[model samples]
Target: MLIDTHSHIYTEDFSEDIADVIQRAYENEVRKIVLPNIDSSSVKKMLNLTEQYPQICYPLMGLHPTSVTEDYEDELQLVEFWLQKQKFYGIGEIGIDLYWDKTFIKEQTDAFRRQIRLAVKYDLPIVVHFRESFDEVITVLKEEMQPGLTGVFHSFSGTLEQAQQVVELGFMLGVNGVVTFKNSGMDKVIEKVDPSHIILETDSPYLTPVPFRGKRNESSYLVYVAQKVAELHQISVHELARLSSNNAERLFRI
Candidate 1:
C-alpha cells in the first residue's frame, strides 16, 4: 500500500472525472490520499471528497499561505470554526510562499505560527507547504517548537542541512514528483536523509513526475515517485511503499 500525504483532487481540475481519477489511483496501488484544504472556498469540496471516499481519502483544515491577505485573521477564524466542528487528520498546506507575491509575508508568518499552535492544541500533525520562504518557515517552526509539535514539510525542496534540521525537529520531509525532475537535484538531498524520516506525496494536479512531466499529475503517478525514491535508497519499490506508508500512518494517525 502507498499513501499520498498531500493532494488537491477536490479542486475543479478533477470535478468532472473524479471517480475515474480515484479508480486509477487504486489500480496503481495508492491506497490512501490525504486532501489538504486550501481555504474556506475549498472546504466543502475537500470535505465532500472525504465523505465520498471515507476509506481512502482524508482531510486537513487550514488557510493556505497564498490565501493569507490583510484579512487573514478573519480567514483563520474560519479554519478554527471548522476544526471545532469536525475531526481533521492534519492542519495544513500551511506555511510561507513568496514565489507569487511577497506582499503578505508578514501576514503569512503570523498565520503560520498561529496554525502551528492550533496543531499543538489539537494534537494533530501539520502538513506544511513552504516554498521560497524556507528560512522564514523554519524560523516560526523553531519558535513554536514544542513537545507535541510535529508535522511534515510537504513538497520539501531544500538543502541537506535544512532536511536534517526538519528531521531533527521531529518532522518528515514530504517527497513528491519534484524529486523525479531530472534537474531538481532533490535526490542528492534525499540520499543523505534517513528514509525513515521521509514520506510520499504527489501534490497532484500539479507537479507531475517525468515520463509525464507536462501532464496533469494524479495520485496514480505516485508509483513513479515511489520507484525513484526506492532506487535512491537502493531498496525495492515494495519496501519503499511499506516504509513510507507506515511513516505517513504514524504521522497522520490514519
Candidate 2:
C-alpha cells in the first residue's frame, strides 16, 4: 500500500469524477491521501470529502500561504475553531510561497509562524509548502524547532544540500511528480538521499508525472512517481511504497 502525503483532489477540479479518482488510486495501491485545506472557504469541502472517504481520506486544517490576506486573522480563527472541534491528522498545506505573489510577505510569515505554534499545541505534524522561500521557511522552522515537532516539505525540488538540511531538521522531503521530469533535476537530488528521509506525494490536479505530463494529475499517478523514485534509489516499487508509506504513517499518525 502507498500513502499520498499531499493532494488536493477535494477541490472542484476533481468534482466530476472524485469517486472514480479514489477508486483509481485504491486500485493502484495508493491507499491513504492527505487533504490539506487552502483557506477558510475550503474547510467545508475538504471535511465533506473526508466524511465520504473516512477510510481513504485524511483531513488537515490550515490557511495556505497564498491565502494569507489582510483578513487572514479571521481565517486563522476558523482554522483553530475546526481544530478544536474535530480530529485532524495534521496541521498543513501551510508555509511560505513567494513564487506567486510577494505583497503579503509579512502576513505570510506571521501566519506560518502562528500555524507552526498551533501544530505544536495540537501535537501534530505540519505539511509545509515552500516555493521560492526555502530560506524563510527554514528560518521559521529552526526558530520553532522543538521535541515532537516535525513535518514534510511538500513538493520539494531542492538541492542535495537542502535535502540534507531538511533531514537534519527532523523533517522529511516530499517528492512528487516533478522527480519524473527529465529536466527537473529532482531525480538526481533524490538519488543521493536515503529513502528514510523521503515520502511520496502527487500534489494531484497538478505536477502530473511524465508520460502524462500536461494532463491533470490524480492520486493514481502516484504509482508513476513511486516507480521512478524506486528506480532512482535502485529498489523495487513495493519496497519504495512500503518505506514511503511508513514515513507518512508515522508523521501523520494516519
TM-score per candidate: 0.99, 0.99
RMSD of each: 0.7, 0.6
Clashing pairs in 2: none
In model 1, pairs of residues that clash are: none
Total residue pair clashes for candidate 1: 0
Query: Which residues of candidate 1, in runs, are more than 4 Å off?
Result: none
- Native-referenced Cα lDDT, model 1: 0.93
* Cα displacement (Å) at residue 40, model 2: 0.8
Please report the candidate that would top lDDT against the real structure.
2
Per-residue CA lDDT of model 2 for 101-165, tens digit only, reads: 99999999999999999999999999999999999999999998879899999999888899999
lDDT of 1 at 199: 97
Give the alpha-carbon lDDT of every model. Answer: 0.93, 0.94
